[model samples]
Target: MIKLVIIGSGNVAQHLIQAFAKSKEIKVSQVFSRQKETIIPLLDSSKITTNFNDLIEADIYIIAVSDDAISKVSSQLPFENRLVVHTSGSVPIESLDNKNKRGIFYPLQTFTKGKDVDFSLIPICLESENDSDFDLLEKVAKTISNNVFKSNEKQRKALHISAVFVNNFVNEMYRIGNEICEENKVPFEILKPLILETVNKVMTLSPKEAQTGPAKRNDMQTIEAHLDFLSNKNHATIYKILTQSIQNNGKEL
Candidate 1:
């Protein structure tokens, strides 16, 4: 079995614990967290501790901490020359302490609190300084997920940026849709099927090919009607800008 030690108590760490729970090949031997109470609900008291000095011997030490704290956390490890990895998309493997072997095991997905995610669907992006270390990382990753990709820091950062545009920015657009619905006393649930269908269409079609709306058709009359209907200046400005963008295909919108 591949023994593992996880450091952190946040959504990523907690989710990892749950994913590894059913794995026969990988065992989470111990989890270190300053806020031990926060992780105790997921792991037993025997396997969770606040002291880094009390860390158990493991094949891999997974630091699932924040990006800023990754270097600091790796530097604080009492042992050296161990295979240590961090779960960060943007942070490079060089950010780890040189005392030990460094690698990255970034799971490309937004982990929300109190929500269980299907780890099998998550894309596990792996990077390491050595081929041997990468093999170990990939082995662990495959136990929970089949979608594993070998990515360097630059590629990982690009993926993260694209994810932000597609996931985070798209969510903001949904929020704006909700606000517009509320302002007009329209039921937001009524739009859920349309939203789902739009998503389904994009699965088999390019976003540009799937695009359909007054903006895509360059219907200026309908665009102006939408702008005039929106009372919020911010919403109107955003609508006009986006409509122009769609019509111009990103040319001088």
Candidate 2:
């Protein structure tokens, strides 16, 4: 079995601990959380540590900390020259201290606390300095996920930016829709099917091809109606900007 040590107790770390727990090929030999209580429910108390000095030997040390803390955490590792990887989508692998072999094991998905995710479907993006380290990282990734890609730093950054558009920005649109529904006393659930259809269409069709809306059709009448309906100035501004972008084929205004 491949021994692994996870550092951190955040959403990604907790989710990874759960995913790896179900994999027979990989063992979470240890987990480091400053407050041991945070990760106590995920693993045996014997396997949890509060100090970097208490970390046991493992084939790989996975740093699942915040992006800003990655460099600081890696620098504090008591050992040198072991495989160290972070679970950041945008942060480059070079952020890791040079004391150990550095790599990235970014899972390209949104993680939320108290939600269970199927790791098998989530895309795992791996990058490493050497071929051997990459092989090992790939092996561990495959145990939990079927979709794995070898991504370089530039490609990973681009993927992350695209993710922000698709996941983050798209969610913001959903929030705005929900707000509008609530203000008008409409059931937000009524739009769930339409939302599903929108997502499903994009699966098989290009986003441009799947586009269908007043904005896409250049229906200024409906567009103006929507703007006039939105009482929130911020919401109206956003609606106008997005409508113009769609009509202009996403040209910068």
Candidate 3:
């Protein structure tokens, strides 16, 4: 069995620890967190400590700390020969500053505490400096996910950007729709089916092909009416910008 230790006790750390615990080939030997309370629930009988020197011997140390604290925590760790990996997508693998075997085991999905993750559907992006280390990382990833990709630092950075655009920006659009519904006294829940359908359609059709709106159809009258209906200046600005962008794409609105 490959021994593993997880550092940090945030949402990402919690999700990873729970997932790794279920794998037969992987053994979670210890968990470390700066705060005693944060590590309480996850680290039952396992070796749990706040001090880095108390870390148990393991083949791999997974650091799931905040983006800024990765380097600092890594520098304090006592082990030198063991493989060290971080879970941040934006942070480069080199940030660990370890001369020993190092790599990134970034799970390309948003993690939330108390929420169960469908590990099989999540993409695991692996990167390493050496061939041996890459193989080791890939093996661990494949245990949980079928969708594994070898992405370099540059590629991972680009994917992170695209992720923010798709997930974050789409959520903002939902928020705008909710606000509109609230003002008009319409039930926001009524849009649930349509919202789900929109996502479902995009899976089978290109986003351009699935696009539907007055803007796509060049319905200038409807666009103008929608903009006029929106009392908020920010909403009006967003509508105008999106309308122009959709029109430029040449999708039959």
Best prediction by TM-score = 2
CA deviation > 4 Å runs, candidate 3: 250-253
Cα misplacement distance, residue 190 of candidate 1 (Å): 0.8
Q: Please list the C-alpha lDDT of all candidates, in the order they appear.
A: 0.93, 0.95, 0.88
lDDT tens readout by residue for model 3, 1-253: 8888899899888888888877899888999977767767766845678888889888888999999999988888886867999999899888896755789999999888888998888999999888998898888888778899999999999999989988988899999999999999999999999999999998999998999989888999998898888899999999899889988895466
Model 2 pairs in collision: none
Q: For residues 41-158, could you state the per-residue lDDT of candidate 2 as single tens digits?
A: 9999999999999999999999999999999999999999999999998888889999899999999999999999999999999999999999999999999999999999999999
The candidate that wins on lDDT is: 2
Q: After superposition, how far is residue 88 of candidate 3 from its true place, in Å?
A: 1.3
Lowest lDDT 10-residue stretch of candidate 2? 244-253
Residue-by-residue lDDT tens digits, candidate 1, 1-253 = 9999999999999999999998999999999999988988888899988898999899999999999999999999999999999999888899999999999999999998799899999999999999999999999999999899999889999999999988998898899999999988999999999989999998999998999999998888888888888999988888888787788885763
Q: TM-score for model 2?
A: 0.97
Error of 3 at 240 (Å): 2.0
Of 1 and 2, the candidate ahead on TM-score is 2
Clash pairs for candidate 3: 216-253, 217-253
